[model samples]
Target chain A: MTLLTSAVAAIVCTIIWYKNAPKNDMKIGILCWMYWGATIMWFVDAIFEYAELKAEYFSPAPADMLNDFFLGLSVVVFGLIIWLVILLIKDPKGVIKSALSKKAN
Target chain B: MACFLISTAEAVVTTVAAKQIEKNENLREVNVSEVKYSHKTPFSKKLKWLRNMLWGGSALLLFEHVWHGEIVPFFPFLTAASNPADAAEMLHEMATVGVTMALLVTGVWGVIVGITTAMEKKAEKEDAAQIAEHAEN
Candidate 1:
């Protein structure tokens, strides 16, 4: 479940990154990389767990799925927060720079 | 049980290496007049891309492991560490799954760097041609 969630996020983020590749004002590449890395990590994890559980890996408890889904969601949120920090620090668009200069004026 | 530790360890090492490279890069100066082409972003800045990818993925995995009680705030920290059998299995998983994930991410970053370098080269050639045309005008 976690793997599915991160993989979906990675796909959507890739599309966004591709569309914004020309402008690249927001640095969406960071988010794309983060989610893609996570998706791969979870994919490997799922493979190993499947090896151990075999048939049981397919049928997970509803509560466990819910928990895993929430974990995946949290991971996505955390990635967003990290990207936001990088954006603010880098200020690729100079939004923060302009705001600070305006305040000084 | 503690598969993510391998990636986490790699991240830690790379973070230190990145910092060192960044410091060295900061000390170096680019001679704009002597160079026909230059990278818009420095190598150190490019390394940050790999650093961010590794750190972000490792942090999320750490959180997930903690959520599942695979890790705890204790002397050994890993639940598998308490049992010799589980500890061995954990080590095996770390070797197989963890190392594979780390290598995959690093490999992807390498490809990204290659693409970026090629694009920069193309841009440099275009810039030189434009400058030559300006000179002719």
Candidate 2:
């Protein structure tokens, strides 16, 4: 479930990154990298867990699935937060820079 | 059980290395007078890409382990560490899954750096061609 979530996030972010490839202002590529990296990690984790659980890996408890879903969502949120911080620091679009200058005036 | 720790440890080491490299690069820049090219991103910045990916993935995985009670806040830290059987299993997972994940991420990062470096090279070539054309005119 975590792998699925990260894969979805990676796909969505990759699309965004592709669309904005020319402008490159959003730095969406970083988000894509982060999500895809996580997806790969979770994929390996799932494989190991499945090796241990065997047939039972398919039948996760409902509560466990729910918890995993929440975990996945929170991971996405955290990735976005990190991206936001990078954007603010880099200010690729100069949005923060302009805002700060405006405030100074 | 604690497979993600491998990547987390690598991230910590790389993060410190990146900082040190950046500091050294800054000092080098101050001591040298060199023509600056616009498209060349620093190596330290590129290293940050790996750091960010590893750190982000490790953090999420750590949180997941904690949520699942595989990790504890107490002494041993890892619940598996307190048990002999589970400790062996945990070490096996670390050797296989953990090491694989870290290697895969680093490999992917290598590809990314290669692509970006190629792109920068192409851009530099184009700039040189334009300059030569202007000189000819």
Candidate 3:
């Protein structure tokens, strides 16, 4: 549920960025990549849950799969957060300027 | 950008339809000043009406899904329950969190759409007024 909630948050942020930002802005591309990365994490989490449900058929243990999935996803989401933060910090004025210019036209 | 393009297209179609209807009615030079204002109705009142109509519809649909037990199978935690009453209680608990997240997503999207639409309308009105002034000159 936490994973899905975070994914929902990312989706909302993406939609807001798309609607308000400049058309075809490079930042949108970055945001989209981040969204897809998060989505992958969500799917991985779901798969782990499903595996746990069918533990009789699976041999290697659900705990291992869950741990690996969580570690991978956490790393990916962390990296995306860093990237997004750096983007927001660097050239913040330029982002607004481009968006405003597109709006004006 | 896709949403903006679609909105602009809709605006164009609306304006064209309005012009055609006005022509058919044989109205000459429709004036904004001719519109009447009611003291009892305020802009906020109209906005509240619109918000209720739109957001209320969405909320009803979401609640319907909850009532029907449609969202239960999606979460693995809820699937462990066998009894209907227990499942309902579990779903009710999960729904508090799920609905809150969904509302957050939808609310943000609505605000973005509203702002974008408002900006587009302002630009279109400015453009139309400019054209009218040029024609007069």
DockQ of every model listed? 0.58, 0.53, 0.04
Tens digit of lDDT per residue, candidate 1, span B13-90?
878888898878656654334553475667777777877778778877887888889989987999999989999988
Output the better candidate (2/3) by DockQ.
Answer: 2
lDDT of 1 by residue, A1-54 (tens): 888888898899889989877778898988887787788788888887899999
Worst 10 residues of 1 chain B by lDDT: B28-37
Clashes, model 3 = 0
DockQ of 2: 0.53
Ranking by lDDT: 2, 1, 3
In candidate 3, position B42 carries an lDDT of 30
Q: Compare the candidates by DockQ and give the number of the best one.
A: 1
* Better candidate number, 2 or 3, judged by lDDT: 2
What do the candidate models score in CA lDDT, each in turn? 0.84, 0.89, 0.46
Q: What are the clashing pairs of model 1?
A: none
Docking class of 1: medium
Model 3, span B7-105: residue lDDT tens? 223334544654565464444325444654322233333333233222222322233233335435464423326567766765554454334433443
- The order of the candidates by DockQ, greatest first, is 1, 2, 3
The alpha-carbon deviation from the true structure for residue A83 of candidate 1, after best TM-score superposition, in angstroms, is 4.7
For A4-105, candidate 3 gives per-residue lDDT tens digits of 544664576568767877654344444443443334333443554566578653444677656545544453455356556656666455976687799999
- Best-to-worst TM-score order: 2, 1, 3
Clashing pairs in 3: none
Q: Could you tell me which 10 consecutive residues in candidate 2 chain A have the lowest summed lDDT?
A: A16-25
First chain of candidate 2, TM-score:
0.94
